[model samples]
Target: MRHLAIDVGTHRFIARLEEEAAPRTCAAFLEMLPFSNQAIHSRWSGEAVWVPLGDFQTGLDYENHTSHPSRGDVLLHPGGLSETEILFAYGSSRFASKVGQLAGNHFLTVVEGADKLMDMGRTVLWKGAQWIRFTDLGER
Candidate 1:
């Protein structure tokens, strides 16, 4: 399994890449490691935050798509018909967008710092969009 880190403020979360489950998505995502973006709290998906990936050409691998994602699961929605974004589940979560509740491509699963998931969510939720960075832990 591949590894990555999600860093927000003082919190650091290690994530396991779902290469076997979502190979294509994992490959594309790993290629863009050390990605920094805003972790915005979703108004639609309860207790979830999303990182918009903008128009990346990552092909769809919906094998891991799910509307309801477990807390601490990191997901990517390879936007085709809609915009692409990364979902981070804090509490109960359902990956959704303006269109409606849609499945998100499961890519990263928090392996460490699981307890900090809720705190990260609450930070982004109450304080507004937070700058979160994804780093390839493999380099370290």
Candidate 2:
């Protein structure tokens, strides 16, 4: 089984991929992969945006639920019901939101400690008959 983990934030996107074919080292894996240039807004006409996950500010305030916020930037996260869930929840939501539309492209996030979120971004893979897992980064 192959697994890709993404942690999304206001400034960047962090990604980690695990496959049976390659050895797993967080630093080594990140060093080899290039940043992905996938369009964030499909309908919007603009240059492609690249968001790496490790660039988030620790104490900055951002909103992740509202699409059109009246006063603040909306930050999306994958769903989790508890405080501990916040970490994976936010990352998962961002991955789910962007992955489908950005298919056939590559990208990265700027967050940290995102290796265990295998359930995130699983649905973004192409059609194939393999053991797949998906973390629905949706809030409902």
TM-score of each: 0.92, 0.17
Residue 43 shift from truth in candidate 1, angstroms: 1.1
lDDT of 1: 0.84
lDDT of 1 by residue, 27-113 (tens): 888878779988889889998888877787677757678889999888888887568888889889877778888888888889899
Candidate lDDT scores, in order, read 0.84, 0.24
Find the candidate with the highest lDDT and give its number. 1
Score residue 132 of candidate 2 by CA lDDT.
Answer: 20
Predict model 2's lDDT versus the native: 0.24
**How many residue pairs in model 2 have overlapping backbones?**
25
The residue ranges of model 1 lying beyond 4 angstroms of the native Cα positions read: none
